[model samples]
Target: MKIAIVGTGQVAAALGKGWAARGHMVTFASREPGTERVQQLLADAGPNASAARVADAVGRSSIIVLAVPFTAVRERLEMAGDVGGKVLIDCTNPIAPGLRPMFDATTPGGATSGVEQIAVWAPRARLVKAFNTTGAENMAAPRYNGQPSTMFICGDDEVAKGATAQLAEELGFEVVDAGGLSAARHLENLALLWIHLARVNGMGRDIAFRLLRR
Candidate 1:
């Protein structure tokens, strides 16, 4: 799989290293193409990975990962041309800084979740929300505590979600179907709880999410 990560942040860097380790053709892209961080990632990724412009990276990749902040997501999407007809994975949590509140199930219009906004942006792209539930450090590791972590994914397109789940499983996570893309709001907020856990306790990224059932 040719995967292009459209950010230089921790999430993108982690995915780049992990996917490259999985033998995927991975590229890390940055708005500033010649930045030291992008150069370092290219060197770190070795021959299997390279640095590219956002549009070029999105064009070449079978899957494009939006790992940037929630506020910056739309701008980045616009920068990546014709993201339609590709598997677009969004790992964003629309978190307002210092807003220690919970997720509002209703949209500002009080109708639906905010994830639908992405749908409006890339009508042709098959968007799935995954990897947002887990920490950045955990992404690079294939396993945790001798067990596989569960990656919960959701999207309107079943085929796209299927592909996303397969990729998650290939990356060594137990993929759990979490219904439609609207569920992404809830999933994104799930991070708040996880972050709170990290704050209240001393849990690190080595800890992963697992859904235990009867």
Candidate 2:
């Protein structure tokens, strides 16, 4: 399947490289028109991988992964044009600085849970929430450890979820069906727990979420 990654950052580059390793045709998109950074990043993605403007990238791909900073997500979507009728995967967790996940204390609602909010901007698009946790370094250099890193996904569309599951599996993660878009609230909150542990407890960047079944 054709995949378009809507960012040129570490997370986007890592996922794009992983997808290319899985033999999927992938493109990395950026807001800047003449981006040498994305061009250099695409070099790691191989010949099948290239960079394009966000709208053009979204228009050509079957799936779109938004891996930009959470703070920039809303405007990024707005600038990416109306991305309707596409499987838009939201990997953003609106984390601010010095605070918790959203980076702001006393925000009331869950922190870093901006996936659904972004989905509202693209009402006609099939939005799937995924890949918000874990540092980009871990994703790029996954240890595997004889177990799959749990990747929780939530969406209103089952078909879109299934497609995301396949992508997650290909990306070397064990997919967990976290139910509908409502589940995004918890996952977004989970980002805080992870951040707290990674930052306060010194758990390390290689740490990822997983569910233990008894």
TM-score of 2: 0.90
Instruction: Give residue 204's error in model 2 in angstroms.
Output: 1.6
List per-prediction Cα lDDT, in the order shown. 0.80, 0.80
Clashing pairs in 2: 94-112, 96-102, 96-103
**Best-fitting candidate, scored by TM-score:** 1
Q: Cα lDDT for residue 191, model 2?
A: 74
Candidate 2 on 1-214: residue-level lDDT in tens?
8998988888898888988888898988887737677677777789789788887888889899999877777777777776788899988787666645553334455332577667657888898998876678766765567777788889899999999999888777888899998788788778778878888898877688878799
Candidate 2 lDDT at 192 equals 75
Per residue, candidate 1 scores C-alpha lDDT tens digits across 88-167 of 99887776567342236444644243356777778788989888888887777757777888888899889889878877
Model 1 spans > 4 angstroms off: 99-103, 109-114
